[model samples]
Target: MPTPASLVSPRLPAQAAIAVPTSRIHALRTGARAAGLIAAGLGMLGLLGGWLHWPPLATLGAGSVPMEPNSALMSLLCGVSLIFALRSPQSARRSTCPLAFAALAVAALTLSQWASGVDFGLDGLLVQGGASPPPLTALAFIALSLGLIAMCKRGRIHTQLSEAAALAAASAALVGLLGLIFSVQSLGGETRSPPSAVALPSMLAVLALAAGMMSARPDGPVVSVLASSQPGAQFGRRLLGWLLCAPLLAALLQAGVQRGWVGGSSALALGVFIALAALAAAIVSSARRLNAAALHCELELGQLRQAAVVFRSSNEAIVITDAQANILTANRAYEDITGYPVDELAGQNPRLMKSGRHDTEFYRMIWRELHERGAWRGEVWNRRKNGEVYAVWQSISAIRDDDGSVTNYVSLLADITSIKEAEARLQHLAHHDPLTDMPNRLLFANTLERSLAHAKRHQHRLALLLVDLDRFKRVNDTLGHPAGDRLLQVMAERLHSKLRSGDTLARLGGDEFSVLVADAGSREEIAALAGKLVANAAQPVWLEGRSVDTSISVGIAIFPDDA
Candidate 1:
């Protein structure tokens, strides 16, 4: 759980927050969604057109006029949605309405159109030579309808909307054209006139929406003149977006002529569409292949997330700073251990946790090491969220970028309070006798060496005494070692309690012991402590079964003066 400060206050550093601004993201989303709706609408018309012509509907009912009214309505709705979509590129909610309309249009057009046309007893849905409108007239009408659409919304354009609308229109056109060609043979090559009625309306709807949407957007000479003057000019990336649908147009021509669905002028127009559609499909496919070839060139990201998750959940104290020695990021763990909210310390220095245990020079050394090596792994004294101080064993490292420059610093730390207690226990064990729980021979040796050095340097005197517990073996054999050990522990305690702060005592394993009296004025002072030790051991000690009395014999020597 994070502290209140961390939860309520600001988080995330200044640099990272600035890199991804909210405004730019919103603009891109609006633009992209508008573009997508346009694409989907065009696709609906093409597919619906292909079905209407290929399946061949001969006048089954009075309603079977020129073209399917439902498809035209769908194309109209798609155009309308696209116009509205100009405002929100990133939004899916607004785009769905148009998509639904286009879908409904396709469904109604397909079913109703299928029912309207009649199937011939022989050669694919063939119509007699003198049926209704000629095939060429229908094609020309579709083109005229699309041109009218372009005219209505030719007010103005900007690079963004122009690029978006243009791309959508071109793609939709190719799709609708291809679909019409594919369906031509099924509809009755010579008699069917549905394509003619549909072409003008569908194209008009598309062109009108593109013009309306583009005009409302901002414009520069580049976007306006380039698009308004040259419908086929290559400007910036506009050409690429337009080129995406080229293959669909070419496919339309192939279905109509190579397959022999239409004749003469219609065939030539179909051929042109076929050439364009083939190229578009090829380009989309080629782009995908090229991207696959350079997959490894992209840098691997997202690995940092796993480690960051672990750091957030951990219970140890943590501190995060930047390459500039200023703290930026911290985690929940830091809040839990320090009683500070993560946000309170964000963008601040690590002084928030200063325990004041070490001097400035000590910290300077640590900083120097970190800067020189790009990492420093060691222990440091840190203050809690409150004023208390604690010892922490920490590992700190530099976070770097691809260019090998340090960006931030991360620290992982653990508390070591129990470790300090263990050290004191080990020191006692080394100096004191285990049986007596008092200072031992090793401690006496260390004290003697120190005393000798001090006496040589400052003309000081020190005293030493060695003692042996008397009649302890008889008591041990009779009452067991437990009583003997208890007697030694009791005597060691008595002598230890009687000693001055400067004095020292040791148990030489079993019943033997020693004492040190430093800077002794005379022989009598040293002898006096030795005599007191022997008398203290003579006191009675109580055992479960019996009361035992123990005594010790003592010897004494004074440092420098005695030597």
Candidate 2:
């Protein structure tokens, strides 16, 4: 089990957060550019009309008022502000704010002139003689300026506020368009006082500028659904043109009747007929879309049900986590293998099971590979809930959403502890004696080679001893092989006891042994150890109700002196 300290601090570093910009955002950028360009072109034409004394460019017809130069200038500023914001969204405060503020100041001064009946000299700044833009036009410019300013900041709330301001500007622009279409000077119904008419070009410029501002942040509350490719969004898009054109068409029809261009009785009948036809068409389209959506939902539900069954019944341990790596769910096999119940595992980080065998860089590499390649598989050691450290072969995959952002991570782990243990056992048996539980000749030879290198490097002497039991074949022939095996075991233990702690003793074969003294002293010291081993074997023993006599011969070699 992970200690409390390890459990609290996870090993994997926090993943670097990223923003995946989708194609929808790119489309929005194109739309914004188009709207900005259209607005700027119209504003330029209106100014040219005033500067050159050409009324047709500023007005829709002979009776319409010309667009004031100040109104044209404001439109130009708003359009340029939008383009700058889009071009440098990261630095909009520095690049786009000044133009937005200038437009705001102009509109504010225009409003002040109207309210206080005082001339601020802001109207007709470019032309000597022309009516000032209408109060509605000034209001629209103010709303567009605020929207552009709001675009300079970033956040959900700021984006929503910007979209809302764009909507307000669009509403004001639409009102001006309607007023000009009806050829009315009144800002409201006929009962109210007549106000200066908003010029046609000014109204068009404001409308396009408002649209550009709305496009600045398509992910905002009002624009997200409009820009989405969902079924509902498709339906909404289909209905948008009809919703916009129907009311204007009706108003024009009513105006025609009032002007005696069409008879009133016939106009009313035609209006009712058109309204019914539109309603029927909308109903039919909505029914077809709803039916298709219902079928799609059913198909998805069936797929989800099958997936759930597979997830639950899988034999390998499976765990799923959210993008932040907090555990969201785990299968039964996962709980069983980890020794953690489902309830205890939920909301916990997977690092709680870390065995502390791997370093921090190991986990960093895992996360880096996972992020870059989306999948990783490797063997790792983890501690179970009961404090047993075990090996597992694990595979991990990252799941993403439509925008290519990581949503979740799913991992599968298979226990390989028994396999690892078997490998270790096999390795140990390859180099050790089976009967005596000691290093055999193979291990002794390897050890001697390593010791020789070390002694050569340090210029130290090493002593090698070859030991033999004299006349051991006679006992095996008379007392049988079992009696010979008993004597060899006894003699091996006696030789081992006579050696120093740092000395190595090994069984070469039947009744043959080798000893290595890695830290050899003087020649006298080496002879003394050899004499002790000889004396140790000279003692007699009784075996099988008969007295057996045993003796040993010892031969020695010194490194650098012999060989």
Query: Residue-pair clashes per candidate, as listed?
Result: 41, 1
**TM-score of model number 1:** 0.45
Of candidate 1, the 10-residue stretch with the lowest lDDT total is: 121-130
Model 1 ranges with Cα > 4 A deviation = 1-310, 313-318, 323-326, 332-348, 354-357, 383-390, 399-407, 415-428
lDDT of each: 0.55, 0.80
Residue-wise C-alpha lDDT for candidate 1, range 36-140, written one tens digit per residue: 355345435433444555222222222223223333444445455554445444432445344544434344334344356642221122222212222232232
lDDT of 1: 0.55
Query: lDDT tens string, model 2, 261-298?
Result: 99878887887887778767876887788889889979
Q: Which candidate has the highest lDDT of all?
A: 2
In model 2, state the lDDT of residue 21: 53
Which residue pairs show backbone clashes in model 2? 1-387
